[model samples]
Target: MKYDGGAQNVLSEDYYNLVIDQSGNKTAQGVINVANDMTISNSASFLTSTNTIDVSEQQRWRNLNW
Candidate 1:
């Protein structure tokens, strides 16, 4: 995943999770973004090659009025 904008305005909490299975047969990716809040929970058990998780970038907006 990639964001090309100048910044990412996340109003509240954000979370993500990823899972991969052995033999490189299964994989999963999850993302949670909310205007006010966000939450994510995940679990997995496996082993494989090229099974990696990465976060490109993150940015928050400033309260212009405050």
Candidate 2:
């Protein structure tokens, strides 16, 4: 997953529960997990490699007043 240029809020006082997971594979397999109030930005690459099996999971909330 890639986050461009933007503001992200993983946790807020009015919300609860946030989790993120990133995985990749080359000759071997690898994984990454982030929990609670995490933000990624600026063309970030979650899992990158030559033979990467790139994978990611994220959960969050946003308020839209319309």
Per-prediction TM-score to the true structure, in the order listed: 0.17, 0.23
Tens digits of per-residue lDDT for model 1, 5-66 = 22222222243422121222222233333233211212222222443323334633222222
Per-residue lDDT tens digits for candidate 2, residues 1-66, read 222323332222222332222222112123233343433323332332333222234543221211
Model 1 ranges with Cα > 4 A deviation: 1-15, 27-54, 58-66
**In terms of lDDT, which candidate is strongest?**
2
- The backbone clash count of each candidate, in order, is 0, 0
Worst lDDT run of 10 residues, candidate 1, spans: 37-46
Q: Which residue pairs in candidate 2 collide?
A: none
lDDT of 2 at 8: 31
